[model samples]
Target: MSATKASKLYILDTNVLLHDPKCLYEFKEQDVTIPMTVLEELDDIKDRKKNVAQEARYAIRSIDSILSKATNSEQITKGVRIILPGKDRDIKLGCLSIFPDHELTVRTGFLPIEHNKDNKIINCALHLQSTFPHRQVVLVTKDINMRLKALGAGLKKVEDYRTDQLVSDVELLPEGHHYLDTPFWEGVDKVESYQRDGKAYHRVARTLLPNTFLNEYIYDSTQDFAARTVAIDQESVTLLDLGYQHLMNQSAWGIHPINIQQAFAMQSLLDPDLDFTIFLGSAGSGKTLIALACALEMVIEQGRYNKIIVTRSTPPVAEDIGFLPGTEEEKMTPWMSAISDNLEAMHEQDERPQSSVKYALEKANIQFKSLNFIRGRSIQNAVVLIDESQNLTPQQLKTIITRCGKGTKMVCLGNLAQIDSNYLTPLTSGLTYIAERFKDFEGSASVHFQGVFRSRLAEFAEENL
Candidate 1:
């Protein structure tokens, strides 16, 4: 039997637009409808200084730009055509319509006509469903509760706006290293080792997995050995020679590696060739402690850079908190408390009797800067540390990274699961974005911290609470 297929109609929620202004054009050939209520919500937040407001303004502007070319509002009601420009000009932009909430005629009487925004938006989609009985209507939103209500009201096909998701599953996201099965050494029967500039190298013709990329680390549990691929060409890989004992024996600024992951982080932080490094972990994983320790060793001990420059997105208060009276550094002290916390922890943990927190800060020549005026300034000859960086958007991260000058080593530390910005998700955060994008870049390394060295209570809270 042959039956005509129903067309798909997707109605967007306010959060989708606020999360990603470009969500309007991601629907491909499916028809898109934006209720007037969602636009009303956008207008309310369009004037603020935070990222949400900025995205709302952009969405509003994009809609206006397309609608300006339309003949009239009635044209939009009937379905207005929009053109998406790109190298592949054949992108099928489905029709976009502004549906009025009051015109909804779904269920006839199941839901009452109300001034509430969610009800209005849902009712609009319900109306579209009733009007086109042969069509499938879906409500798209990043808000969980909204999706629940839509389903409760008999709507189907409610889904998360996945245009910005970087990975299909959280656990599958790169941990920057892999553990090899037993007999790893025996498989490498043709292994060759050599010395270069007092360092080591290895060439192996082992049967490796297809996903092995440049700078990929392979850890062997039986022999307790680890190696990284320096070069890869299809069937063979050249490994930068290294062993577990050497890494575990090292300490940076009196801070020894508490786990294998921290050891890798310290190595990456101390490597001058790796001008860029990223650390990802949850709370109490010692990510920041290891990074700050290595920065101190490099700047104050090794004389690699002039100073330690720290900055992060001023989140948890992107909008106005209140007026503060102080110089720039003084004003930034409250936000830099985490930096001071780790710095003081380092000083307390230093093995030397004469070690002092104040003296260490002075010796390191550390500077706490803000992201507000980071634009147009070239930061050179410094060890740049960006903490709590998950709050940054990808575009914002690009803006900050592009400002790195010659001889500057940039380091980022953050937990993707703890992102606070409403405009971001773990899969779309600046930290994950950069990690996935820069995994193959030369002299760039990323490490995922594994253990929680803090109090047992803290560990319990992280796992249970």
Candidate 2:
């Protein structure tokens, strides 16, 4: 494969690589160019103590593994062939090249390199655009401002890296449930109802709910019926009949659900068979509260799990918490305050609320782990609660999720609307990615809560603001 033979040339930005280290292989047959400035940035970032430092190291290794195949500097600059693994072995792809933008003598029509690293990157893309006029040269970056600046600097094509993006709109993501205006049974003409081991199930034609996924809840507006889709086949759908009253009356650690959405979330969290669960909602929507409550019930009351592991994605700049005084959990206290607040809320009615909170914390054997330190460990016999998951990229999420071992159930809770990562949007968030990707997995479930139960003021603000 040659650079000129490739259909398009894509110049990748540093953030795109950090967002997904394996993204180099995602651009099928399109040739890729890495600016010298991007390599410099990655080198500077790889030694840092932040979470992104790990990704930077991975990206550098990936680039090296591919470029090491080249025998000479000329071949490296011209382009090196990219060979994919396994089934893609026979497919011919384009090349990977390192652009020496720093050596270019021409300064005309290029952004001043001294302005900032962004400008230096845009200048590299601009130079490529002018050199490869016949090729569809595109600058792929996650930064919105960078894309705009590249276009302003005469770059013909600019795009956000969308190879990992599963959906263009967040609203199209699954809400974990389907609503019916009429009674569920009323819509189905042929239904087979049966009982097994004191549990009821209804089998209906798959066409009735063609778009439903495994573990998705099905309920009607009448408030009299509710069931979870446990099995789906080409011809029929199997629903485990969970009575509406049963779901509404469910309690975990004495915390009863205030809404049907919360009821659905609690059901999934409490189910012994569900190993992976996701909760998507706004602040004050009971995501953290419900997850914590269930974690306590499962760990302390039922003994289903030995302990609870709580972790979350900290801000990129603040991920280096070594400067903070105390042990890992103590250093994480500031960020994990929401967990404490929920525990306090659960014990608010106790005679000694503070003491009760302390006792519950001790009894549950909860450990506050850092996302930075969670890599490369097999966590067993635990219910892992991942908060603020919207801030994570797909690769980061996969790193954490893969740590789960036998007898472990992981619950990821995130408010997509409140994502803090500049490199992430709701459509490209790991929360959305896993929610959609795991919808068909029989052991996983997802629920999106719509109500805000924190307080009246909080509810009003969430609605209006």
Best by lDDT: 2
Measured over all alpha carbons after superposition, the RMSD of each candidate to the real structure, in angstroms, is: 4.2, 1.6
lDDT of 1 by residue, 1-465 (tens): 011232788899998887667877888777788888888899988865454566688899988876777787787776765568889664647778888765553445345655567777877877777778788889998777778988999887788887767776667667877787774676666777889988888877646545766666677776467777778766678877667877787798889997778877887788777889889998999988888888889888899889988887776564432354677677667878887888777776566624577777888888887775566789999999988899887666776899999999999899987988766678777788888888788778888888777889988888888
Model 1's alpha-carbon lDDT is: 0.78
Residue pairs with backbone overlap in model 1: none
**Candidate 2 TM-score versus the reference:** 0.97
Candidate 1: list runs displaced more than 4 Å: 1-6, 88-92, 102-116, 181-183, 222-224, 313-328, 349-356, 359-372, 375-379, 392-399, 402-405, 423-425
User: What are the lDDT scores of the predictions, listed in order?
Assistant: 0.78, 0.90
Worst 10 residues of 1 by lDDT: 1-10
Give the alpha carbon lDDT tens digit for every residue of 1-465 in model 2: 254667799999999999999998988888999989899999999998877889999999999988999999989899987777767455556789998877762545367666488888888887777777789888999999999898887888999988888887999989998889888888889999999978899999999999988999999988989999999999999999998889999999999999889999999999988999999999999999999999999999999999999999887668788989999999999889999999998889899999999988888888999988899899999999999999999988999999999999999999999988878888888998998899889999999999888899999999999
**Total backbone clashes of model 2?**
0
Q: How close to the true structure is residue 270 of candidate 2, measured as C-alpha lDDT? A: 91
